[model samples]
Target: MAQKERVGVVVSNKMDKTAVVAVENRSPHPKYGKIVVKTKKYKAHDPENQCQEGDRVRIRETRPLSKTKRWELAEIISTKAI
Candidate 1:
């Protein structure tokens, strides 16, 4: 099976070797037929600890590295501008 991937913005990188990413999912409401945005936070493994808050990154599904870390950072798409 192909591993799942997600593109999201890094929300926090306070933990060592870990980063919290917020991915947004947009879908039409079942009853109202209006677009709704849902955000989910995922803990991704960042071996290099390169991610910082507000950075855009790509994460891929991987074997659990820790209790809540099932995703690994693939690449830094864009960094937060200073």
Candidate 2:
């Protein structure tokens, strides 16, 4: 089966092999019918530590690798030079 994937920005890469990504979603409010922006953060396993803050990335859902890591780095959509 294909795993769930998300496109997001790398908000932090302080861990040795992990990155924190923030994914944004927009939806209409249930009652007000106004657009609402929602952001969620995910811990993704970055085996090579290639991701950095401000980089755009694609992450895929995987078996839990740690307490809060259920996603793995799939690809780097864009890079932020350090």
Candidate 2 Cα deviation (angstroms), residue 18: 0.2
Whole-model lDDT values for every prediction: 0.97, 0.97
In candidate 1, the residue pairs with backbone N, CA or C atoms under 3 Å apart (3 or more residues apart, or in different chains) clash, namely none
**What lDDT tens digits, residue by residue, belong to model 1 across residues 1-82?**
9999999999999999999999999999999999999999999999999999999999999998888899999999999999
Error of 1 at 73 (Å): 0.0
Give the RMSD in angstroms, all C-alphas superposed, for model 2: 1.3
* RMSD score of candidate 1 (Å): 0.6
What TM-score do all the candidates reach, one by one? 0.97, 0.93
lDDT of 2: 0.97
Write model 2 residue lDDT over 1-82, tens digit each, in one string: 9899999999999999999999999999999999999999999999999888999999999999999999999999999877
Candidate 2's error at 39, in angstroms?
A: 0.6
**Candidate 2 worst ten-residue window by lDDT:** 73-82
